[model samples]
Target: MPTITLSEATFAKVKACAEPLVDDADSVIARVFDYYAMHHAMYFNGRLGIAKPNPIRLPIGSRELTHTRLLTATIDGRELHRPDWNSLTREMHELARKRLGSFEAVRKVTSANLRQGRFEENGYRYLPEVDFSIQGCDANNSAESSLRLAKAMSISLHLTFEWRERDDASHPGQAGMMGWDPTSRDAGLMADGSSRSWHDATKQAIERIARDRPRREFTLAELEALELGRVVKETGSKGATPEATLRRVCQELRDEGYLDFLDNDGTYRLR
Candidate 1:
């Protein structure tokens, strides 16, 4: 079991915060990631064996570690390029744009290892397998905010960590972090004050996601591939000429209740 010890002052503050929420005294204040690791908050889709991967990157400085040591020290110790964190962050940013999308900035939220100015370095970044998805948890603070970001961003959001807000809610690992009761179901989406499938009213939302895509168009093959691949590609690139006939065709088919593979043909087509 992994445990973290905090300063007495921080502990006291977190304890005070947890009092109104639970029946027992909370010992560990966790982050979104921590709560997830401890199995406090859970997501349903993981049981289905669906996983998406994400990279964890943090910034560190030269003082904390020498450039030579970082560059050469493998988990076992070996020769490599610059060991400083700034270089690592730059590399990770490139990876994110290439794999996820161009707009998923890797700089602002990155971390660094600074050792009293011995060297100015940033954090390290690497890709890991992730299930579900990522979304920029925006203005709201409840668990509902997480789902909203997932839908609106049209991307998978790792619900492990989110921005902390005293006004709305605390960060996932805060002293009084909210947990999902076993009986709670995923909050259904709404529009016009009615519950609907995620596919409902997603055209505009999907379009917004496409705005961030680097490609100007997707081919017929690409469209089906994305769908089957559990990706969220859509047909709304800015000023796409002729609206890329293939994408339009796919959207039309999808909109008309045609989203299954034909048993006989082994291909997706209109119902």
Candidate 2:
């Protein structure tokens, strides 16, 4: 079994936070692990698994302390294990950039890393994967003060996923266990059965206009008079005519059974 040790300062902060709720180092470690596991499970849809940890001693400054803990857990029978830390860190940085209104400023203060290990218990093996140690430093504070603050505020989230089953079975792992790519956006359909990316808020506006004036057979000129046409014109780049965009939208609506093409005079009625 491999022992994972935290720095002296980190251990002190963790002990202080856990001391109020539990007695002894082992209980404190278990409580912290449980808290993280519960929150992680809540954030992502997955089954919760059990974690067992054994406390060990390590030298911290002049004192011998139980700052190292050996953890073992099995995470089989779940569709997804846990979210990737790199993706979470990138999201945090992006959010910070938006909130702070400066990308360069926020980039200077955030960092994260992933840790992994394996263990065997009672003839069964398990792999332990902790998500990250995400740290945020205050750029305005003095170097020493900032370091202290960062150490106190640092968070290490833990999670586990099954790896032994694939090895034992001598087969490749299931693709579903890998989870969805964080950067990939799922394609969504609009009311007209067109790709949601085809237009901005104009799609919703078009639906609203059609629903409001169900009995009204709209010509190209009449449709262009509505808010949907104005939105398409405003959002479109130069040379992208509002009339052309509106015509395409109507055709899509007609194909999706939401609109009836009235003759060949570029007119449509809501179905």
Model 2 residue runs over 4 Å out of place are 1-214
- Whole-model Cα lDDT per candidate? 0.29, 0.37
Top-scoring candidate (TM-score): 2
Error of 1 at 35 (Å): 5.3
lDDT winner: 2
lDDT of 1 at 164: 27
Per-model RMSD to reference:
19.2, 22.1
- CA shift of 231, model 2, Å: 1.7
**Residues 1-271 of candidate 1: C-alpha lDDT, one tens digit per residue:** 3456768897676766442222123222432223343353246434321222341111110011111111111111222243222222233333344444433232222222112212222221232222112221111122332222222223332222222223333221121111111122122223232333333333333343344555422234444443322222222212333224334434433534534334332234333
Return the TM-score for candidate 1, rounded to 2 decimals: 0.19
Tens-digit lDDT string for candidate 2 (25-133): 6545655665586678756555443232332211001011112121221112222233332223333433444454553344344332112233232221221222222
TM-scores of the models, in the order given: 0.19, 0.25
